[model samples]
Target chain A: MTDATATRPSIAGEQRIDGSDLLGDVEFLVARVRAIGSGHAREALAPFGLRVRAYAVLSLACGSVSPTQRDIADFLQLDPSQVVAVIDSLEASGFVRRAQHPRDRRVNIVEATEQGLATYAEAREAVSRARDRSLGSLSAEERETLTSLLLKVAF
Target chain B: MTDATATRPSIAGEQRIDGSDLLGDVEFLVARVRAIGSGHAREALAPFGLRVRAYAVLSLACGSVSPTQRDIADFLQLDPSQVVAVIDSLEASGFVRRAQHPRDRRVNIVEATEQGLATYAEAREAVSRARDRSLGSLSAEERETLTSLLLKVAF
Candidate 1:
């Protein structure tokens, strides 16, 4: 007997249909991509003892500007409470240091330590490489189109 | 004195430029979108006392056939430890119940309670509307393009 699951008949006088059309839904596809990327990053960062969020916080704090907690949270689109934990972890690891703001006592100015910056630099490269591998299948032009479309949606 | 900050060009231009150059970087964009969506969902689900992860877990449990803890984690790309806390909270809130799997003694089959399903149904609609409002600025065709491009990147 023919494998019913493996064989599907095409419409009369029409081109054959692969499962691609049925398999393709933009949202679902993106969701799967994201899931895969997140998993990869989590594993990649684990050895360095950094969560993705902590690495991002460090990346944003690498510049000379001593960003406030609110600034970091806003840029990262994270809650103030959530930011506290990420900061705490970094601070505990001595990767980041929090200072009292001169003008605003309520605001905590955060900066990446030398250790933090070094770790961030390496982690960023690793992340970039991992991403490159994930998008390796797509052409450069297709990649550009995908990024532009995401920005268009986000902005 | 001229405001020192006044001459500091806005990051909006930088954002656009980065968007153009970094279009093919799907992993980077995925992280940003997840951060943004998590923040937005957090605000909307606040009244219902649900974090985005929690809501997703409950929703999956409600809809899935024989969803185990591993299944939810795999679907959401969340860490097993994180999934445990999320499930623990849902179980505590009486929104979900965990049972030993009939076939696999090692697995716990998670299912949403009536209250959980009801809550999820309402939140799902609200979340959809919130996403619509968030993307309202885009043209219908743009949204389609955005979704399609994201799928291509993801798949």
Candidate 2:
């Protein structure tokens, strides 16, 4: 058999010239990690019929506040049309429903059904496991610090 | 006048229940940071006739190694077809060209032209400025720490 691994081009190897080049860039690193994490999440969520985007919408809906479509769009940084499509899919599956916001009647709220909550709880566990596996190289403290740093830049 | 900012639903406000939740998840944080960074990069690269994805491909092409389409796809975690499209656009714009890989006759390498290199140099500076502005809230030390942590996870 050919040495398959030997022939594989390593990104780190290719980009490690000065150790402070494009690969070390914050935006590039964030995109890389997100891509890897999303890949794992996508596979883990497949059994639940959820993609990352839909799962994000579902997760937000399962939160304490009932989010409107606009809320989901704004929070997720997704377009309103994209949020609507995800919500439509979730609504079709009976995982979520559109209800009037008690405090704001003009806004339609995305509320999770009991089934949705149950599904989300299970999906959350799967996603968490996948995320942890992806970050297995980092310790708990490192992960905590990474999260804090990311929040500072992200928000 | 309408208070447009007030009408916007804040992502932080929507998810600040216990100070830690799904929004605080590492994967979610990575995704959020990537989104924000990409938004900034998109605006900065627009004048250069590049989007974030194309810029990534260009950056890789401008690197020390003459990367193959497969290498670009693998390193960038983009689909091969997507990389092909980006390369096509870059090629058409005269920023890049397909050349024969000396070591591997079967592989076509994506190499930057003189014009491409010059354009990439300018684009890199613009992107760096945009990245720095987006990360202005963080101290230089914090940014360095974040970059180190991200490199560990990303690679």
In terms of DockQ, the best-performing candidate is 2
Residue range B19-130, candidate 1, lDDT tens digits? 2112344665666665555556677788788877687777767763637787666656678999899999999989999987664577777878999989888877666665
What stretches of model 2 exceed 4 Å from their correct place? Answer: A1-20, B1-20
- Report candidate 2's fraction of native contacts: 0.48
lDDT of 1 by residue, A36-69 (tens): 7876777778878987778777766675465667
**What is the C-alpha local distance difference test score of candidate 1?**
0.67
Give the TM-score of each candidate.
Answer: 0.60, 0.87
Docking class of 2: acceptable
Q: Residue by residue across B1-155, what tens digits does model 2's lDDT show?
A: 24455554433343322222555788888999888898899999999999888888888788887777887777787789898899999999999999876555776688889988999899999999999888998999999989888888887
Q: Write the per-residue lDDT of candidate 2 for residues A34-100, one digit (tens) a residue.
A: 9899999999999999988888888888887777788777777788889889999999988999987
- True-vs-predicted CA distance for residue A83, candidate 1, Å: 11
Clashing pairs in 2: none
- DockQ, cand. 1: 0.16
- Tell me the spans in candidate 1 whose CA falls farther than 4 Å from its real position: A1-128, B1-25, B148-155
